[model samples]
Target: MNVKGLDYTCLTLSIIGAINWGLIGIFRFDLVAFLFGDMSWLSRIIYTLVGLSGLYLISTYGRICQVDDAR
Candidate 1:
């Protein structure tokens, strides 16, 4: 149940990203772009950061699952 701090942070960001996507699909709202201003450099930076967080989660989950399978 215990996760590393970085892992936890990445997971939290990933959840935020997912919720934003849900809103976009269901309500046509882009939360990140709205909060940061669409097409602006700041918004783009946030988008990139969120994407990196998701990638981190993917790699972390893969490593954790591999360890569990080895046990």
Candidate 2:
């Protein structure tokens, strides 16, 4: 597996999740819910994917940071 590509994907999803959280915190808006309906199956899938991506990033963070620090 190409970890580089997977890392990018995870980072992107995590960023999207973060932005959604920020919107909810500042404006009480839920973009996923707005797009897919509250607690709907599709929205739940999206939420799950975003959460999984965040978890993946957490696992890879230390390695990623070490690589950056080496440069």
Clashes of each: 0, 0
lDDT of each prediction vs. the true structure?
0.87, 0.93
Q: Give lDDT: candidate 2, residue 15.
A: 92
Model 2, position 44, has a per-residue lDDT of 97
Which tens-of-lDDT digit does each residue in 1-71 have in candidate 1? 45688888888888888999999999999998898898799988877878999887878768989999999
RMSD in angstroms, all models?
A: 3.1, 1.9
Q: Candidate 2: where are CA atoms >4 Å away?
A: 65-71
Least accurate 10 contiguous residues by lDDT in model 1:
1-10
How displaced is residue 64 in candidate 1, in Å?
A: 2.5
> Which clashing pairs does model 1 show?
none
Stretches of candidate 1 exceeding 4 Å from the true structure: 1-3
TM-score of 2: 0.85
**How would you encode candidate 2's per-residue C-alpha lDDT over 22-54 as one tens digit per residue?**
999999999999999999999999899999998
